[model samples]
Target: MNPRDTEEMTATMKRELLCVLLLCGAVFTLPGQEIHRRFRRGARSSRVTCRDEKTQMIYRQHESWLRPMLRSNRVEYCWCNSGRSQCHSVPVKNARATCYKDLGVTYRGTWSTAESGAECINWNSSLLARKSYNGRRPDASKLGLGNHNYCRNPDKDSKPWCYVFKAGKYVPEFCSTPVCSQEKNGDCYFGKGLAYRGTHSLTVSGTSCLQWNSMVLIGKINTAWKTNAQTLGLGKHNYCRNPDGDAKPWCHVLKDRKLTWEYCDIPQCSTCGLRQYKRPQFRIKGGLFSDITSHPWQAAIFVQNRRSPGERFLCGGILISSCWVLSAAHCFLERYPPHHLKVVLGRTYRVEPGVEEQKFEVEKYIVHKEFDEDTYNNDIALLQLKSDSPQCVQETGSVRTVCLPEADLQLPDWTECGAFWLRQARGVYNAPSLSFLTASPFYSERLKEAHVRLYPSNRCTSQYLLNKTVTSNMLCAGDTRSGGNQANLHDACQVNMSVSPYSEPTPG
Candidate 1:
């Protein structure tokens, strides 16, 4: 019975001991510390308990002297003797008092004979305030010193209190300043807890918190935001928490409240109520022909196929009048006939031949009298159509008319007016390709026309007819770089003439 029973009991005891250790470990671990000591519970508290016998004794003495003598008689004394020969005062059983026998002689005892010791401070203003001494609560209602008789026996000197005896002060009851995250726990401490009190907190620019007797409301947590282009206002947004974000109600005893948001970075106008100026759009109907007619239809028309023979030769023509076609005088200088100078009616492009082919009998080729063979001026010439075909007079898609300046009519002859003969002398006779043609009565369809540009004689290689041959009446219109180099060169795009002979009848 002895050996077997002893072995079993020993093993069982070891198992039980291990279980107890595990349970205790789980229940008692020091928080925020690496050490875990079961012996710590019995250690001394850093602060003495207020209810302890020694503390009670000290408090009782303070209260006794403060009441019977200080409050009722406004005077008290102590019996302790201090140096500088010696100092003495009457002893009060409850209080550890102090007395100044002379200027520099102070004695610590139970009571003092002095009327009101210099060491003891007093507060007599309507709004009483004071600081703590010996870490004790002053009898605020007693009216001995700084105490605002509001809260019954309020822990007066317990806080670093501030009092305003006068009405005005630059400093408010609570002041505030922003704090950075690097601060102690992101905390902006104030006067009472440290040495004085003011408002401060832990909030970021994009974030917010509360402070200042809970009077200050801060952050954009409850506001709303709208994108720059948003059609509606704050309430219309589904997700806008606030102008900034939803960071509201971060209420605190001393927080300054604010609402902020990341404003939409709108580079363009979002709302239209604000005044703005924009160019008026000219809305016309019809096509390029209509555009040209809306203004003076006189364009520096390009007459292609000047030398071709047969009835299909003249690729295009410019309307010199209802009866005449202004063309390259050299086109007829060769003594060409109706077949050899076939005029393409309403020719817009050379590659795509005109839909209607007009067999015109060159009635008479009247070249400008001064036309020179070398530099061809009076390069201007009128090809009077045969009087036989009356159909030529009618306005058809193939044949049309462009007004001409009267014999004595004068114009500034600007290149933009299609008077670009000046530019033709120069190597760079570049014109913008017309794509958007204004609507009007002349053009049937939206046709893309060639832009005509006139470079000055300064850019010309030949000087013979630099300014003479390419006269003011003679204008040049067409894409200088014809092939496909023109940017807006669509097959049917047209440049509608804006200023028309109908509008300006005669040049000013």
Candidate 2:
């Protein structure tokens, strides 16, 4: 009995020893820190003082040799546990740091006290950096600022420094300075808490700034554009570069010398005084007609006696169909009347000064049923020409019939949508002899303007529709996501509009 039991015990002992040796090798040779390194190193070899002023800490000085305990190039965590008299290491030039009192130190990833019996930490540096142990990207969490990029490096090329933050799995959102001296080509921007194309002046409040290039605007200010002095408004107070701790705020100077303050203080108000142009409210010089004649479906409506027709204003019409004659609706308003109405069939507004004008006569000028006498909703009317002149498709080069749509269609909702309008260059149609350049149609905004009122279905619905059925009959267009002005002079030719039917049209 004694021999058998001794042999069995000996065999078991050998197996246990082998198991211990294998386990030790596996723990020491892995990719991460060896088990021996789990305890703290009495002191680190070097120090790295955070240099950037924007860094959160108060000039934190850290151990450089802490790199080995940390996965090099990876983030490592460390903690401050309110140890009043912990010792720290200070680095000397070209030499590893020696321990000193009142500074913190960790040995093999664990915190220790110079005196005996300090509690081990749960949130020691290593544990803090390794909270979500799935080996994923660190969560650079922030409060108030929903998700944004937390940048490790800054870009040199961009103005108004920005931080790159990880928005989501590989996405990033940058938080940049909004006060820009000039707009950058593709950079996104926000001002007064509104986003817009980095290049355009932001005039709308709470309006998200958009992206777009800039162009010098040349034209007399329409009376409508005149600033209201009493309503002058203030912008933001931007910090000046001067060290006196002063801030300069921009305020919009309104017409008539009055001021309004919303976000900041109004600095100055001076009249531009540019209200003296004598040309018609809207007119074409002569060049926009070339392409107009090329479109088989296009029709031109000319208004006669735009200013002072006898007893009433007269307007000419182009028979788009038996159901429609394209004429200016303004021609038949109560303020203008239609007693002097006339329809000029073949047209030549320009002639050798003395030659008689070309044309046709109107039996009646039927203005649009919903046309507003004051606002001119549908700027068109039908002139029943004397004895329906033949639908001359040939004389009218491109005589394609324009189809109409129902007015109640629903449009999508948006913070804002752009509108564009186009007018051809002068002489582009009839007399190629003159400049054929036509200016763009006035970029008129709906609802947001001082004149246009929002429709109930359009504004009062459960949601707002930008191109709803009400806009079906109206030519509607918009800006690209870039936020550029769709009505700028260069893009003016691309503007298009449609006629929309409204159930409750504005009363005439």
Candidate 3:
């Protein structure tokens, strides 16, 4: 009973082992079939033409595997190099087929069918034919052909060539005119898309157009001429128009690669009208006599006396321009007529006349419009002189014009300035008839100048003027030194004479 059971069990185990081996073999064969299917599909999709005998024989070995995948009913094969046929066979690709139909007649049989199979039939024979013809003819006959014509056939052959009749030669085709054309009028044309159209002149180069932003200066042109503002394509707000005739010529500026007319005059220095003469380096402190040339712009103003017919010295002035004199407006307290006033320049002595002294009559007097009599605010006045020539006092070593301070000029507090004037003093003398009689003050008779420092506005307020309105325009000057008796005080008591009866008088 044990032997029979062992034999049956061995047979069943053999059968089970054989079934497992067969299942493993089937699993491996499925992948091989899938691989074969993929290879056949690829071969059928690509139209590979094999012209060489060796290549044809190799392809035949693979045909059987690929034939089942082919869907086309009719198929012809030819050797193709870069999509063009290498043999005498026609191209099957749609693009190459069309190209053969258009230009094949020109280069037919010119190429070998199968010498080395390296050169193929160029289906685009029209391009090859045009290139061949172009090399044989003069460049003038092909001027109309664009640069791209080298790779493709031009649409038409009879297009006009860019030939110059006078030069008897052809030029290359251009997108626009290379040179500017002068019109019947003064305007000119400098190619298309350039804002320089209608310009008087233009500059350019062979390879490129003129830079549209380049600037051209036409000097000293009358600004009255109508400007070509619109043609330049500049906005109106970008420039200023000078209607005043005294303004300088305008300049044309290039903006945004376009010409823009604008005001080009450089701002003149405020010191331009100032005399260039160097000031005397040797300066003196305290009250001292000044040379006539040292203060050439100094002036002595005289007014006709109402009681006496003779003129009387009134005040001092400064010559600021060729025909204008600046002085304290309060000097005209009597409201004297302009004809009654006279200006004496280059005078060193108060009474005696100087050699370089020039006299001038006043044509007009203009006190500051905002002058205040009580506070002496805006005490300046301009006197226009009456003269035969345009200039009143000829500029000389002793009669040059002085520079007027700018309106915004500021000097630090305590800045020393020379104050020129004539000083007078009186000495009491004992007499028999009177207890003490005072003689008329002895006039200095010479131009004396004193160094005075400017006082800060805060220190020169209404409080110092006894509650008087000390306006902003009013300026205060005083001696900067303290606690010292002024030996030769000049005009120190001019404002304090009311407080002290014995104060010295100052006349300027």
Per-prediction TM-score to the true structure, in the order listed = 0.26, 0.25, 0.37
In model 1, the number of clashes is 54
lDDT of 2 by residue, 1-508 (tens): 6998999999999999989988886776663464335533784423324432223343234211111123333332322222211122222211111111111111011112112122212221332333331111222211101012111112222221112112222222222222222223313221221222122232324222111111111132211223321011111221111111123222222334433212222111111111121222232331222222222222233344556753211322333442234545554555433434443332223221112223444455565677644433455555554443222222222233333324454544322322212221010111011111123242211101001111222332212332323233333232323333323322222222234232322212
List the global CA lDDT of all models.
0.30, 0.28, 0.43
lDDT of 3 by residue, 283-383 (tens): 33334555567667777888888887798777777676767876666677678898999999877777788888899999888776666666555556678
lDDT of 3 at 457: 66
Candidate No. with top lDDT: 3
Candidate 1 whole-model C-alpha lDDT, 0 to 1: 0.30
* Residue 435 C-alpha lDDT in model 1: 21
- Stretch of 10 with least lDDT, candidate 3: 428-437
Candidate 1 Cα misplacement greater than 4 A, ranges: 1-315, 347-359, 387-391, 413-415, 419-508
Q: Count the backbone clashes (under 3 Å) in each candidate.
A: 54, 67, 2
Number of the candidate with higher TM-score, 1 or 2:
1
